[model samples]
Target chain A: MNLQARRTGFAVAGIAIICTAYSARLVDLHVVKHEEYARLAAEKHSFRQPIQAKRGMILDRNGEILATNLPVRTIVADASHIQNPDELASLVAARLELEKEAVLEKISTGKKYIVLKRMVPDEVAVALQNELQARKLRGIYLENDSIRTYPNGAMLGHILGYLNHERNGVQGVECTMNKELAGVDGHRFIERDRTGKEIMLYRGAEAPAEHGKNVRLTIDMGLQSILESEVDAAFDKLKPETMNAVMVDPSTGEILAMVSRPAFDPNRPGDFQPSQMKNRAIIDMVEPGSTFKIVVAAGALNEGTVTPQSSIFCENGRFSYGGRTLKDHHGYGHMDVHEILVKSSNIGSAKMALMMGGEKFHEYVRRFGFGERLGIELPGEIRGLVHPPNRWDKLTITRMPMGHSIAVTPLQITMGMSVIANGGRLMAPTVVKTIEEPDGTVFRANPPRVIRDVVPKETASFIGNALVGVTQPGGTATQARVNGFEVAGKTGTAQKVSEKGGYAPGKYVVSFVGYMPAENPRFTLLVMIDDAKVDSSVNYGGIQAAPIFSRVAERAARHLDLIPTAPSVPLQTAPVVSATTPNRRL
Target chain B: MNLSFLTIRSANRIRLRPILITVAVLSVILCTALGFVSIKLSQHAVAEEIRKTERAVTRLRSENEVLLAAVTRLSSRQHLTSLVAQSKIAANYITADRVARLTPPASDEGDSATRTALNTVPSRSATR
Candidate 1:
């Protein structure tokens, strides 16, 4: 072959080899490793942007907002994109009420994402955004965020509860209904430009956020205000260690108002002690005192152990049994069941319990919804302490009759009274009325539920009539009477139980549980004051607690727009100085 | 001489036809490329507009939420109660006698002349 022809042949072969290599590489890139390279490219430019779902609002029964969300912004810094860190930091610090040095330090890190400050109000954030735009500043961005707010402050703090730093509920209905209140968050795969701005055209695979359902409570703010004001006055005037009040509709067992003194503001939960956040109504156990007399009285009547007209000798105010002598405030020769309850005679109550027998009395106590959880919507409820008949000691039967041997929650005592007020049925108490969507569509409605019937209607009516006499002129709790309404209730004056396994001397827990317009009850209220600073003479439930009940019931009646049915009675001006026979037992 | 002239002309025509076909294909390709670029630019502009609208809507929503929260705080019972106390507002619960009912209560045991007047329903024409 000629030299020119050989060179041409070599050039042609070289060109052919080059073309084949390029073709093989193209095939590998387009087919063999396509998915891997595509994924890597996507990772470089695309991100999963989380769409936060909003938490729901808590409302009162009348549609008043109790707990709600306040929209805010979280200021973030992309230090890599920052041009003038000092200027941006100064502007942010001024707008966010933060230290300029801290913000500057954060922006100088050269990190891709740095949180400069959180919880910046919307107005301030908007102002800062405008200022940034005006100055052509970059890197600093505002992200959407929110905070839980309780507009009523500490008014219904215990019932509404508060959120923690992580936005989880810590107590009360907030904890119990958290699943319904916290919504499902969504996300989308979005591509961003080199400047860290999202490319809206390249957005893909999105799921819309599902916001939380609103929780409407059964509480009426008007009634809650009345109860809180009255309880606050009692807490100040009496200077008690602790005070609690709970008002419920006896017909439906809906909690209208519940308040505890020393309450912490939910907006600032960190400032208060854990004790201040306790809902004592369902948590604190106390010896129910004479308020428990209704249990024995009702049991005796329902069990046919004693008729309403049956008379029992009071041992002339002193009765000795099981190597102990039980006493009453005043000596009485003979009294019927009605007079026994009217006087709150410890001796008379003990005699009735003896007639009913220990097992039967315990059954009645359980039937009245004691010794178990009443299944309220609030968190951290205790079942209270009630000894079975087998656990009773020699004097347990007698001592338990007058509320000395067993401990019970304030809620139990209130529900026990509701057995009579609600015509023998024990209704399960609930604070939640309904769960609704953001658009006011109800997701779930909590209807009234009856747990069981404690006694017959006739029996309940009889016991109710007897309780009415308790607030009459000669009854133990005459001060509990509301003008133009028949107040049916019982007084409890239990000596404060000591942490060292005995009664605390010179200290008492007084309470009054009552319902007004006794013929047709509207609400059942409970007022309990623990260790009032008043003199022992004026520390009885009739004096310290019943008067508060009167004030609250009167205000609640006015709010409920209940017409006056009974004849107006004269108000008691001075405390009735009557001594309740103190029962001293272990 | 005639055959020679015809052959040359035919050869010229063949060259001219290939040139025309190349020009037509190039023009079509250029037009298609321009059209694709124009469509992409339009899409980008629309996307930018959508992004701006979305940002504005988000900002407005946030502002609305802020206003709602403020309104709730101002009208809360605690705030109103404090206001009443501070300003000495005469906000008292109306007595039962002052409340006019749509339907008068069945029993008139405690009804006075003022209560009767309050309880009595107004005629529809009068109400209108």
Candidate 2:
């Protein structure tokens, strides 16, 4: 073989080895290491950032803004990028009202990122940024944030609810309508320059945020104010353990105003006890006393077992049934159904129930919306305790008719009276009127919904007339009458149930449930006071709760613009000033 | 014989180098001038558009924030109550007897217009 031929063979062998190595490297780069390299490249240049959607506003029926958001910023520091840690720390401490030493320690750590302050107002944030830019500072940054604000302070706290740190609703209407209020957040992937400014030309895969829809409630701010003022006054004066008042339009089941004492401000809910946060108007249960009489009277009349003029012997106000004796506040002879309600004769009511039987009477109780949730647009509503006839003891029938043995929420009692006020139809209560989009387009509307017709119009009218007698000169709740109007109402003075089981000693829960203009019912209102501080002898519902209802109804009637159906009766000289209804023995 | 001799002399002697050089220099100057003017015009147009858009965004944002702040202040129950208490506004309620209406002929009991008005009519403060 020649020397030139040997050299050419060696060169060809070397070239073949080099080509094989190159092909292997190409496969590794394109397949095995591709994902890792691509991820690293993306991390170096592009960033995924969230575009936050604005939380919705809450408004009243008249479009008054109840809850809103104020734009703010969160201040952050990149310790590694800070040129002069001391100067930056001092600047932040002065501007943000932070501890100087803490700020210094945070900025000196040489970390990639650190949160310096949160929820800085937009104006302050802008001012601080301007000063920093003027001084040619780096490392410090501001990110968009927001804070929830309730401008009404504590007025509608329970109804409006509050938001958590993550802007999620935690209670009340906010919790019930959270999904609609939270809206859909969007995102974008974009390349940022070295200065942390987004390069718009390199923006990738962007989506715009969908803002939360607005919620319009059925609450009337004016009526709410009136109710709050009157209830607050009563709460302050009576110093009750708990106070609850609810006002509803009988014609439509719209809740005009609702208030419960021991309320916490939603803006500062953290400062209140868990007990104070309970919306007791719909959550707490109590025996409704004589207010439950209307159900039996209406039931008997509707069932054709009795009429408005039907007579029943009262057994001289003391009756025995199921081995237990039932008594009334007064000993009476025979009384008509109208007289039974006016005198709040417990024995009369019980005898009437006995005539109607337990099963039929229980059906009426359920039909009047007791023992079940009213399905208001609120959270944590409870179906109150109502024992079915099968679960009832031998004495349950007689006792249940006079509002013992049965537990009911204040809202239920109000709605029960509304059954007569609205002419025998039971309505589903609603708090929210409409759900609106950001552009004022209505997404959903809540119109009046009739649950069922509990009785005929004639029966309701007869009951309404009897209820009016309850607030007349000789009736149980004469104090509940508003000047120049025929007020129809019932007074309830129930012995509270003891936490240790039986009836509590010397503790009473008193209430007044009523509607005005006996001919044309407008609003049905309920005021309940539990464990009032006054003497037990003066703590009857007609004495304690009726006057409060009267004041509230007067203000409410004036606010509602209801025309006087009856000639103006002379205003009584402060009905609460006198103890009209003695705490009679039962 | 003399014409041929003259033509050869002219061809060998004088060249037009100065005229060609002048034309080339003039063409280069004109092209440079045109390019500078075109670049400056584009820059001005882009800068103006950026300014206009920035101004528009700023104005809209300012208006939105102002309206928001105003509404927040006005609708506040606390503020309104304070105003009423201080007699800055008259919101005292009118009783049913104080109101006298020109009753419409043959109105029914269910007529909404005959119902009590919930809103207050402004009354002068006694102290004021």
Candidate 3:
């Protein structure tokens, strides 16, 4: 055979082989890739799934909700689906109370999705949906959404804080417990026609959302509301620039209610001043005034420098120190350590403070949890300022005894007083109690905590006795007493120091710190009214602040089922016995 | 030779190879389709149960809201004040309008008895 003929035969054979391979490859591509194509198509119809967890609820000891989420309706829009933006916006605005301009602005840009309005009423939402259909307003929509409702409105506004856009908590416990409060979001992969109506119930990939965990708080809703109402009334009557109050279990350090006035409703925070959003009970600091005398008296007893039997000569109602004149409420000539507090005698307190000196006074103050944060779960906590002994002058030492020349937040002062009422122990005040899973399942719980022991037990009794004396017939805070329960506390009326460190006259911070059932103290309450013009310039804690303390304490005692104190007797006044002169009775 | 060839041709024409190949292909395709459908149906049942559970959660939340509202109403501060006023409980300390001038002579005798009676009577702070 010729070489050319053989080469022609081999070329034909090679061409035939190549053609068969190409045909087989085409068949494989058409048939074998079917599953992949189907998967891609299914993916196009699927919606993104969000994790949704059952949010925890805040409950009272009795299981009342302080904060909880509710099912609500919202307005959603698909910009692409809207054929006429103007028509859709007009109908939605009238139904949802949103401005047409706003609604149109959201979808006019032809974005795929937009929210027109949130938290619409169920009835109004239904009507809006009906209107959308009736008017043929394409893409104007309503959808089911969840909203958080604080049943006790504005009761624990600062503690509960609130959620904003994207369901993120902004402040307070809501923000602090965002992890527990925020449920996982969910997605639905339903098959919808071009008109967006459901064709098949579901035809795409889906993963159900797991709901968020629920959080239960330690707050009692009834107690919270009671405190809130009382504070509100006091705010109206006293008209303080700002006011705050705290009630705590002295023994347990469990914070019952800590309310700061001029508060905003978390459900609608827009109506209030943003500055008022801070929880002044734990954040704002001012010279605590004479109510702080309880700390000094407790310190004196702890140091064994004085006792109820100890006596001192009050400087005839007037004594001078550090180029400043100190005055006593009464001309308590020769009085016992208890008398000094009962009468709020500044002269005696100063003389005793001189004996205490800067080092001892500063030490006691630090021990009382001053100059330290409470480490509460809430945010924006400020550690009140307590200048070190090195920073104190002779005047500061004297003034510090009576709640001046130093700064402390209202909450810290209450906690300090609680040490005396609770037999020398201080607790870490808590607002949250527990975290729970869906269907009332407890996941994490917070137990009552003892922060530390601030003083000796015997010293606490000595201070408690003197505090009780203040509510006696002629004491400085008789009005703070509960009828059935013995009330032990002190009154504070301090002149606000101006920016220049001078007394800003006529501006006063009036407050009262007291404990009920003085014999067996359960709760210690502190009421602080800032810039209080008591009784139309009523700065006296006995007259203005003490009354609120009385109402709150009495009611709280009864509500908590505490043992009431023995009634006060109109006993004959006892004559003065001891006449010790210039003793450190304060 | 012609008769034998005709007989052989008739037998070859009735050969079953092509029919068997067609049946085998059809059966494999149908079985694959059935398996795919069975898997989808089982997943659908699971998805439906999840939907039911989600609806149950929504229903429970609404029920809780109603109960919370009831509690709020009963414990309202205003309600307590009205109850207190209606009950007319007497105070433990009956302070006179004037503190400094009050004499010990004005205190009620047998104060302990009055307190016992007040405790028994739930109408007011003090038993009338």
Query: Highest DockQ among the candidates is held by which one?
Result: 1
Residue lDDT tens for model 2, A1-586? 6888989988998998899899899889888999998778877888887888888889999998888877778999987678878888888899999998999998888886799999887778778988988988888988777777888887877788888877889888888899999899988887765665555556678898898999999899888888888877767666777888998988889998899887888888888887887888888989998899999999999998887778889989778877878887889999999999999999889888989998999999999999999899898888899999999998988889889999999999999999999999999998999999998999999999999999999999999999999988889888888887999989999999999999999889999999887788888899999887777888899988898899988887787787767776775565443323343210
Chain A TM-scores, one per candidate?
0.93, 0.93, 0.83
lDDT of 3 by residue, B1-128 (tens): 45775676566585578788888888888888898898778776776677667656854655565455556545544444555668854334323332243232333465744344445446665446
For model 1, name the residue pairs that clash: none
Query: Which pairs of residues collide in model 2?
Result: A559-B118, A560-B116, A560-B118, A561-B115, A561-B116, A561-B117, A562-B116, A563-B116
Per-prediction DockQ comes to 0.68, 0.19, 0.12
Which candidate comes out best when scored by TM-score?
Answer: 1
Off by over 4 Å in 1: A1-40, A574-586, B1-28, B95-128
CAPRI grade, predicted model 3: incorrect
Residues B81-128 of candidate 2: C-alpha lDDT, one tens digit per residue: 989989998996665557997775443456435334443334578336
- RMSD of every candidate to native, in Å, equals 6.0, 8.0, 10.4
Which consecutive 10 residues in model 3 chain A have the weakest lDDT in total? A577-586
Candidate 2 ranges beyond 4 A from true positions: A1-40, A575-586, B1-70, B86-91, B105-128
- Ranking of candidates on lDDT, top first: 1, 2, 3
Interface RMSD of 2: 3.9
